[model samples]
Target: MNLLHANDQAGAYPPSYYAATRTPLAEFPALQGQIQADVCIVGGGYTGLSAALHLAEKGYDVVLLEAHKLAFGASGRNGGQVGSGQRQDQDWIEKALGREVAHKLWDLAEESKALVKNLIQNHQIPVTFHPGIAHACWTDVQVRDSHVYAEKLHRDYGYTHLETLDRVAIQNLIGSKVYKGGEIDRDAGHLHPLNYALGLAAAAAKAGTRLHERSEVIRIDHGATPVVHTATGKVVAKQLILACNGYLGNLAPNVAAKVMPINNFILATEPLGDRAKDILSQPIAVADTKFVVNYWRLSEDNRLLFGGGESYGYRFPDIIKTTSKPMLEVYPQLKGTKIDYAWGGTLAITMNRMPCFTRPYPNTLSASGYSGHGVAMATLAGKILAEATAAQSERFDLMASLPQQRFPGGAALRWPLLVLAMTWYGMRDRLGI
Candidate 1:
């Protein structure tokens, strides 16, 4: 089954809270006839939109095609936590690749956050960006390790935005007794993901990108001039960028091997009014130390936007029951709270959890497998892709150097292997191993 049309309707956005609250923009027409451009981007998510906007600013003709509306995929349907560092922490990167490379990666990560804020401010995007993300811990071992990492970041990295929180302090801040301890990164923040993505689309169009909605790429004839075939039209360009992330099916087999798609679910509670303060004393986003993480934050309308559920298959589970189970575990007081909305989204992941930035062929580059830290990283990747196209390759080369392993089992068996591995990890998470 085609995952692009698996759960959602064709040419429509999911019935998500983001869709309801987002400021709507005029939709672009579907591709028809033939088109040519300096660059043809196959996906219209953050990475594609970013590249489109940046390449347009550099005076390159850009064409961006989306299967649905702009930001209709994971770009609009994420936890919205703009995290710091790579998906794998700096320490892990340091162990895998040396300290020098790790430091370079850290600098690039910081640049990603700055690029996002600059875009929002410069373009006047209505998405309200906030600061502070608390990493809640379940065990004393996890708590102590977090404290040590905070100090290392400050001392070694010259970063001092993180504050270590004891158990009592964490409870006071989050209004939850489940957490043993935690640390808050004042540098990290959250925002309405869908609005932010739409803002990028508007900005890219204004900068001269020809964006076509409902223009799904059926295949790409890769060569000196790659021809991207949509249902009704085709785009032949000097360079091609594959930024589909989770929705990237078998279009590019080389990328599909390294990046596996997985589904995650979320739900939003009805307006909590004064009770919202009881769940989160502060307005920061909270993510706990679980293999399958539980992330949540209060929406601007005072609703608890909680995300936690797992599905290896293309389909999502029953929305309410699948998500509510984890939300109640964190805030049992919300047992009877009504869920106003629920949705599911797919994201790409690699074996090492670092993003997969690779050039599958000449004049063709693909950036995906961000895992869950796509908010900042994916947006920044667009800039890197644009730069590489413009013949500036420093930043893009640094990211492409990171290791990304292919799935052990090929096409037929990859999905089964991933399901088995995830089940084992989920069991360990429940056993607190």
Candidate 2:
């Protein structure tokens, strides 16, 4: 089953809290007949929209095609934490890619966070970025490791936004007795993801990008000049960008080999009112140390937007049942709270947990496998893609240079292999080992 349609209807966003509260963008017409452009971007999520916007701003004719609505996939459905660093921590990057490259990646990550803020400010996107992301640790060892990592970031990278939190401090802040200790990154923040995506779409369109919704890409003819075909129409362009992320399917066999798609679920509670303070004393986001991380934050209306649970299949599991168990574990007092909305989204991940950026063909570029840290990075990726298209390829090449490996098994068997590995990790999380 195509993940895009396996769990959702055609041309409709999931019934997520984000979709319920989105800042609406008027629908673009589906692609018809044939069109020509300088760049043809597949997938209208953050990467595609950002690339279109940046390219259009640089006087390049762009066409962006979306299978459903813009931001209709993980981009709109995810927990909105604009996290610090790449999906892997600085220590991991340093160990694997050396300190020099790690430092450059760190700087790029910093720029990504800034880019998101600047886009919101410059575009006047109707979203508020409340700062702070608390890392709630369940074990003392984990807490100590986190503190050390925070120090490493400060000493080596000159990052100073982290504040260590003791057990009492964390319990007081999160109103949860389970966490032993953790740290808070004051620079990291959260926002309404769907609204931000819609705002980007609006900006891209205003910058002269031709966007087509419900125009799913069916085939691509790759060469010096690439042709992307949809059911209703085709796009002939000087360059092609594959920004499909979790919904990429078999469109590009090489990218599909290294990037695997997994499903994650989230649930939003009814407005907590005064009880909001009981869950989070401050307006910030929190992600715990679980292998399948539990992330949450308060909505502007005071609702708890909690995300957890994972499945490897194309179809989503019972979202409320799968997510609420973990939600209640963190906040047992919320056991009886009304769940206002529940949804699931697919996000892609690479073997080493870093994003996969590559030139599958000389004239074709593809970026996906953001792991869980796509919000800011995906936005930056758009600008980099635009830069590459403009023959200013330093940044894009730097990202593509990161080492990547295919899943242990090929596409046909990767799913089973991942399920086995995730099951083992989930067991470790349960055993608290």
Candidate 3:
């Protein structure tokens, strides 16, 4: 089943809390007939939108096509945390790809966060960057490791925005007794994800990008001049960018080989009012240390927006049931709190949990498999795509040079294999091992 149409209606955003509270953008017309541009971007999420904005600002004739509404995928539905580093931490990156590459990647990650902030500030996007993300740990070993990692980031990377938190401190901050200890990254933060995407789309459009909603890319004729075909229209462009992420479908099988799509769910509780302080005292986001990580933060109106639960399938499970169990496990005080909205989204993940950046064809560039750390990286990926299209490819080449491996099984069997692996990992999480 095509994940774009598997669980949601055609040309409609999911019934997510983000959708309910989104700062609406006037819809762009769907593509018709044929068009030509310097760059054709597929998937109108963070990467594509950001790419369009940067490319258009650089005076490139850009056209962006979305299967549905902009930010209709994981970009809009995620936990909204602008995380500090890449999906994998520095130690893992250093061990896998040397210290120099790790340091460069660290600098790029820092630039990504700065880019997001700059975009919001420059465009005056109707979103607030609430700073601070707590790394809530369930085990003492994990807490120790987290503290050590925080120190490494400071000592080696010159990042000193992290504050160590013991069990008592964590419990007091998050109002949760489940966590043993952790650390808070004051540099990292959260925001209204969908609004941010909409702001990017608006900025891109204003920069002279031709954006087409409901313009799902069905095929691509790759060569010197790539042709992106939608159902009713096509874009012939000098360069093509595939930023589709999890909803990529079979557009490019080479990318599909390395990036596996998975389903995740999130729910928003009714406004907590005074009880909001009981949930999070300082309005910071919290992500726990679990194999299938649980992340949450408060909405502007004080509702708990918690995200968890994962399934390696096209169809979504009962989101409220799937997500509420984990949320309650972390904060049982919200046992009977009314769940105002529940929704599921598809996000791509790679074998090593690092993003997969590839040049599927000489004229085509693709970036996906952010593995849940896309809020900032995906935005940066767009800017990099713009730079590469503009003949400045140093950063793009560096990201593409990162070690990316295909799934153990090919696309046909990868889902089943992931299911088995995730089942085992989930069991271990329950067993606290």
Please give the distance, in angstroms, between residue 10's alpha carbon in candidate 2 and its true position after superposition: 0.6
Model 1 stretches with alpha carbons more than 4 Å out: none
Residue-by-residue lDDT tens digits, candidate 2, 82-176: 99999999888988999999999999999999999999999888988889999999999999999999999999999999999999999999999
lDDT of each: 0.92, 0.93, 0.93
- Give the alpha carbon lDDT tens digit for every residue of 405-427 in model 3: 88987767788888999999999
Structure candidate 2, residue pairs in collision: none
lDDT of 2 at 121: 97
TM-score versus the correct structure, for each prediction: 0.99, 0.99, 0.99
Worst 10 residues of 3 by lDDT: 309-318
Candidate 2 lDDT at 242 equals 95
Q: Residue 4 of model 1: what lDDT?
A: 94
